[model samples]
Target chain A: MPAITFIHPDGKSDRVETSDGESAMQAATRHGLDGILAECGGNAMCATCHVYVDASWLARLPAMADDEDALLDGAAAERQPASRLSCQIVITPDLDGLVLKMPERQV
Target chain B: MSVSGSPVTGGPSAIPHLDVDPFAMNFFADPYPTHEVLREAGPVVYLDKWNVYGVARYAEVHAVLNDPATFCSSRGVGLSDFKKEKPWRPPSLILEADPPAHTRTRAVLSKVLSPTVMKQVRDRFTAAAEERVDLLLEKRSFDAIADLAEAYPLSIFPDALGLKPEGREHLIPYASVVFNAFGPPNQLRQEAIERSAPHQAYVAEQCQRQNLAPGGFGACIHARVDEGEITATEAPLLVRSLLSAGLDTTVDGIGAAVYCLARFPDQWQRLRGDLSLARNAFEEAVRFESPVQTFFRTTTRDVELSGATIGEGEKVLMFLAAANRDPRRWDKPDSYDITRRTSGHVGFGSGIHMCVGQLVARLEGEVMLTALAKRVARIEITGEPKRRFNNTLRGLDSLPVTITPA
Candidate 1:
């Protein structure tokens, strides 16, 4: 299992191993990461699972879908180019050291 | 205004092209026609200028609700242009996220609200609902929404959550405004804002840790805070979600159930003959007249729905009411028959994001309706009922009924 680290918006961080085929949101949730709220169960509809992917890893991820882009626009935290809805970002073996940051709020 | 350029494009047939404002409709005292037009206008019709899609059909609405991935809720479940205007508050901890995150939060809540845990409080809840219904039946003529529906949930929910009822009057107004904001910024939002202004501070105060009781849901959230699951500050917001989402929805649901049974004497008689129908009656009422009319979900990509290309980032509104009465899915969709086996209805939503507190709502409905079915032999309208104006909720402001006690 690959390791994933989530740095809370408040600068707090927790690292957990990602199960094969689990998305970043799932790993955070299984480990009980403080700030990630995937309210819609990984459907890109609710922006509650908003996260800022490390800029270095941005190019490696797939392009944001139209729906993900629209919902990201509604995230409670300021939207950044690195901001991606965690539900849309599926975890694959190619990306190893994934570091994501939580948003100030999910609503 | 032509339907193409007007706000009421999918409005009732009588005024198809005109802008139909609910508040204005409230004055006329009936919006059933408007509901019909919206239902007839295809599954995803443009609500004129408001870039949101209106889903009035039964099948599609339930499909969208169940598939959170297709109709995502993360962009704040409300109608606010979440991209531009900041929400009055944060997204709901449980209702507004997709799975994995939604799964985690829901797990915590599901554990808390499990049937087993609810059983602990079931007797108390049943007793409270029964007592309120008993008291109301004694009066013979009462506003069903206010006296029974509103009274029962308001009294019991706050107690279960462990909050003091010193200034709980604001619960309905606050929740009404909160749910209204989910729709377009129309007259309904303006009114809710005005009505909620006075009670903002008290509501905020209730969210604080000091105000919560030790053994209730609110305090349970506080305990989660101590365990570092959620911040202490975020605890109140979680409590706020339960309080806001839980109250009026159930109240309206039960009220609608009673109203339907009263309107259809045969169903009422069937219920009277078989007291066991109380449970089915609640679900039947939800199917006949859904408490939640519509909710919006943003598509994750340029998804294809019913052969229509839902552009990425576009908002698609699911009309649960229309879906409940979808002619294709339900036989005699409009009729309120308690005996109908309505298993797959979207009244409590579908999928992982379905209502977490549904059991609580069901219990509330069952207790009240059972008491009424047992005590009343006949019920009829005493006067014209007043419908409450809300963007997302469908309920009466006042339901006047004359109960002929058995």
Candidate 2:
């Protein structure tokens, strides 16, 4: 199992264990991390499970899909350079220690 | 937990059984009490009245929806299973479908109703909402349900769909019949079907690609058929899906929000104070009083949920409204608070089959409430609020309310 670290707005971090092929959103929700809402159940519809990928990991993350890029424009908080929908980031052994910065608000 | 009757010796596991008629008019009027009963019964309880299994707890309902392969929707989302009985109408390509089939149709609709498309239509919808709200506020007293809830959607949704204005009045009746037909063949369903003939015919004709004006959702859907993404036959049915779901659900959703704000003055003031809360307010109202209450999913295979074994082909009624207010899932679940995070609630259901047009529905509710919040200082109920009963939807039919200028 690979471990993923989620950095919350308050500077708190929770490292969650993830199984192969599950999404970062799924790992966060399953671990009771409240920041990721996943309102549409990872369908990329609600844009609630938004995150700012760590700068170091941004280059390694999968390319953003067209719909996710479009929906990100409607996210509740301000979009940043490394902003991405957490649900779009799939967990794999290559990304053993993926880092995500939780946004301040996800409506 | 007490087991009803005797333990089953056959395939399905023995679960607590209750004879609660979910479609009863009285129960529909005030279902919280029954919801409490079902939630208390267990995670999975058998409804002897409807001869179906039910998942009232939020965790189970969420899991069931997230895993559509097991609790499938292709077999009709209503109580009547499509495999056992023929659907009253051609099945919805997106709503009553599973993967692959559901995948293709959903992509077309997903692209059509995507947030990008909603953002494009936002300005017009917001303008229309303001115009309608301003006009009704002049009266100072009106039926919120009919005047605003029904009026706003009827005004803008058709234009968005690109239907001609003449026979547009039939959309509600057509939607009523379509949603009502989701439940059993009760008197409500029968009566709605009786009165909806003309509306249905009109809607059926309008769903055709030629009848719709170009450059609208209907035409956009048809264009996909031309691109070979969707079949020509599935195109009209997809448009029909929008016609069936888009209007009435939003009507009830906006109605529920107005009713909640009127009934709970504090919440209304909260929205008025910070107009940004309009979106969250609508989402809260949806959670507190879910407009689309329940949907049935047929078990694709024998499955064990919350320690109860449901056999293959058994119907499991997922209590969306009950799950919305489940005490285990929400704190002060009964309260209508606008400031809470409500996006995760199942008011719109969850998973891939979740309300495909939710962003559109949210835009309608958000703008309507924002317009009202900006202009109206207080909302007072001048007459009794009446519930508009439908087999699957819960909303107000008439709410006599007087608004004070902000």
**A-chain TM-score per prediction?**
0.94, 0.98
Expressed as tens digits, the lDDT of each residue in B296-324 for candidate 1 is: 88887887666555677777767777677
lDDT of 2 by residue, B1-406 (tens): 2224333445555577787888888889789988988888878888877789998889999989999999999999988899989877778888999998898888888888876687789999999999998898899999999999999998899999999888887888888898888787899988987787798789889999999999899999999988999888888999998999999999999999999999999999889899988987988888998999999999999999988988999999999999999999898998999987575699899988989899899889999999999999999999988888899999988999999998
Itemize residue pairs with steric clashes in candidate 2. Answer: none
Question: TM-score of model 2 relative to the true fold?
Answer: 0.90
Identify the leading candidate in terms of lDDT.
2
- Can you tell me which runs of candidate 1 are displaced by over 4 Å? A1-107, B1-36
Candidate 2, DockQ score (0 to 1):
0.41
Task: Give the interface RMSD of candidate 1.
Answer: 12.7
- Per-residue lDDT tens digits of candidate 2, residues A1-107? 99999999999999999977999998998888878877676778978899999999999987998779888887878899899999989999988998999999885
* Cα shift from native, residue B298, model 2 (Å): 0.9
